[model samples]
Target: MLRRNLPSLFRFSSSASASKPVNEEKSRSVGRKAVSTALFCLTGGVALSALDDLAIYHGCSSKAMEKASKNQEVVHAIGEPVVKGPWYSASLAVAHKRKSVSCTFPISGPQGSGVLRLKAVRSGDDSWSTFFQSRDFQILILDAVLYVPGNEETQRNVKINIADNIPSPSSQACTRCPETRSPGKQ
Candidate 1:
């Protein structure tokens, strides 16, 4: 009995059992770290998405859409009103330190569907940027192009100018969009 008990005491099986808890503890720590990292990434992604949505809604994007809706030509071409397209299909370009914004998005109505492209420049100081008010950031130059399919596809550029400056009939597109030239010029 003494000889059998002595062999058992010196056996490596006892040492292996002692180290099992340490290995399990190490694995638990690794799992915790992985979970923490996943949570952190999820939080960051949510925050960025919220910020993007906020910027889109409170910026010139909404202002341009609002101005388009009020235009009778746009209403007649597109039909009853405005309907925004899928978020993934829409594109937004912001430049000049957020003073300029260009938006291209799909819109539909009861009678027709088309793409709307608009560029707007912000006026006045951004001193009240911290305050979220639509009144603060005025849209200085809001111009849009509409493609309406009538008997044939008709392209119309609506240069909706603020600051009491009316768009001349010869200028079909805004200077901001360089691709288009004034009529009889090019």
Candidate 2:
């Protein structure tokens, strides 16, 4: 009986020892899974960042286009001003007897107030030579559309105000040249 009991106890301890290796294998598999998941997430994040950078480099990102689509206001033809109330007002007109186009807009927001004036001349070939002006700088644009972002309330309040044609005090100085050449000379 002692001999039989000894063999049974030996079998029990041997089985417990065998299970230790299985437990270790299971823990190793779990660690491998955790590492795999981390690597997959890291690769995906890097790929997404690269795509975003590419989009921005190409001019308009998906995020920016999405925002622009949501906020864009289109003005059709001269004399049709796009007014977004309490936020901005924009108007386009043909000036100098249809030889030039003028686009004017006023911006008001938490940042401050300023006016944007754009002037374009029709070339002999029917193309446009455009100029853009803001408080900070002036630039020439071959062809471009201006976009201003605003909320629904401000857009709703916008209307066609003829007074917008009147230049602001700051702009008056630049637009007027002291009536130098006599009012009827040219």
Candidate with maximal lDDT: 1
TM-score quality measure for candidate 2: 0.28
lDDT for every model?
Answer: 0.63, 0.41
For model 2, how does the per-residue alpha-carbon lDDT over 1-186 read when each residue is reduced to its tens digit?
999999999999999999998999999999999999999999998996555333222221122222222322323111133332231254545444444545544433332233344444443332233211111111222122333345765433322212223533333565444656877788
TM-score of 1: 0.56
Prediction 1 global C-alpha lDDT: 0.63
Off by over 4 Å in 2: 1-14, 60-176, 179-186
Cα TM-score per model:
0.56, 0.28
Cα RMSD to the true fold for all candidates? 8.8, 16.9
Task: Give the per-residue lDDT digits (tens) of candidate 1, residues 1-186.
Answer: 999888888786778887998999999999999999999999998996566545754465566667767666667666776776775687777676556666777777775666666666665565646434443345555544555555644545343232225643444464564587669896
Candidate 2 overall Cα lDDT vs. reference? 0.41
